[model samples]
Target: MVGEFCPRLVDYIVLVGSHSTNRTSSSIQTPVILNRFPPTDHEDFVLPPDVALFCQPEGCFNVVGSRPARANSDSSTPVRMPISFVFTLTDKESNKVRYGVCLNFLRPIPRRPEGRKHSTSSVPAVGEMPRRTSDVEFSQLPLPRNSDRRQEDTGLHEKKTQRARSSVRLRTHTLTSLCLITHHPFFTKFRALVEFLHTLIHKLHERSRSKRSDRETVWGVLAGGIPSTTSSLVTRSVQEIEIWMLRLLSAPAPVPGKTCIHLAVQPKALMKPLIFALPDKSRLPLVDFPLHLPIQLLGISRTLRILVCLLLEQK
Candidate 1:
């Protein structure tokens, strides 16, 4: 029935097995298939282990491993391990790729072979399988001598090892590319500046509390360290960046690079410019300025709104 519908279903089905020696017994090792679908162009696909076919069926539906042998079948026919299933796929070139699933099958240990005159007792029997590379016990291998050099040894080899170790530390910088605001050098500097400002503000408050009459001197000291021009420049740059981001968000389709800018500005009407949020959160309307806005400004706004509400309530 599968052959009639999916003619090339048998092509992708694969069987893999291995052998291992454990103590006095030997067993067949089955290779694992990580993916059912074959990779396409520019993609790498890991191929299964190459094993001699014990049984081949016409199609996935007619796979011998999944079915029981007939009651009257000859005993000489090896019973195929029935732990795998088959599936099909069609690629861009219209070629059918059949994929199969099978478990690793372990067979019972057999007696030693008898054919060769010089064959040692280590030789496997005619029906017995040989041990696979993965099945080799680590305890059986010869131990290596301790040849590690002390860190104090300033040889060329030690220097090379140190450099390699340092290079691994440098690899952590690669993660900075994952996010701009959180990982960019600019943000790092901005964070340091904010910390310095916070410390400065705390110091200023303590000084003002002690010398309540010397308000002008306190303002002068604060202005001296952080020039007005420098502060203005930083503020203008931040606002400009925010405006640029708002424009990008308002565009018909935002570019992937600026898709990180999700600061939603209120639109006058439904036909006004659209701000595209990440698809997961796009359904809800989000309106807030991006980045950490000045806390002082938020406090001032809250105080003014409260005063206006009080005035309205009294009227």
Candidate 2:
């Protein structure tokens, strides 16, 4: 029976569709080689070097384009076949593009059991019944019909619950590890921003000492005049941060929940030192400005606000 139902490999040849993502204005044209049917051997073919042909057994004359149904199976249900098609396309610039599509229909074959073989006892004589361990007949033995079935069902349910819990634990661990990897880039950029902000604050103090008549405070000067040395660096770092936040926002929820919240909270916590470093803050007269503000320096306030809102909404 197994030999009768054993699977067989088949091959086919068909044209596959191809599409280009380039935005060239000129239209594609057919190559001169394809104009002739069955071009000569000397002519170049469009097949790519990377593509390989499928290998099949020798002496097999049959070419099955469609899956064949089993002899005893119902005709209504037809088995799907593993078939593939290959085609080539040429653009107006004479560049060849090869396309291949394949349907995966390979199924795993069941392996036979292998172990030590045991010798079977000889059958009893024709008229004699088989040797019995007890007087009770097999059919007459006690059978807990409903109770046994209930026990079996309970066992199956417990096993399923355990498997589900283990799977969830595995997923959570994976998420945590990936979140750490994602956090590294954000942390590096944050450190750079912090260092630059500190330097800018110190530079503002130096400028205040040099120019006695310039009564503008450090915060006021920052609000009005951009620093020459760290302006581009600050802008690039802010852009990087915004990009990281956007990526974290777009990532799969629940998996990235902890990472997102950590990102939102850490920024507020670290900005405190930068705010304290600002000299003459009391005389700045900037009522609208926040004392402990990292966004003023980074310029990613709007993006950060949107990110926080999105994260909260997701929660």
- Could you list the CA RMSD of all candidates, in the order they appear? 34.2, 33.1
Model 1 clash number = 6
Top model number, TM-score: 2
Which 10-residue span in candidate 2 carries the lowest summed lDDT?
A: 172-181
Encode model 1's per-residue lDDT on 1-315: one tens digit a residue: 112122111112222222222313222333322211122211222232331222222211111121234435643222332222222233334343323222322122122233435646787788999976553676577765454344345476787886665543221100000001110112222233223323333354345434432222222222232233333334343344334433422333223233533222334563232233223333532323323343344676775786688989953
- lDDT tens digits by residue: candidate 2, 215-271: 333422222232332343344443444354344334331221122222231356565
User: What is the TM-score (0 to 1) of candidate 2?
Assistant: 0.16
Q: Which stretches of candidate 1 lie over 4 Å from their true place?
A: 1-9, 12-14, 19-97, 101-105, 111-315
C-alpha lDDT of candidate 2 relative to the true structure? 0.30
The CA lDDT of each predicted structure is 0.30, 0.30
**Against the hidden true structure, what lDDT does model 1 obtain?**
0.30
- Residue 54's C-alpha lDDT in candidate 1? 23
Clashes of 2: 0
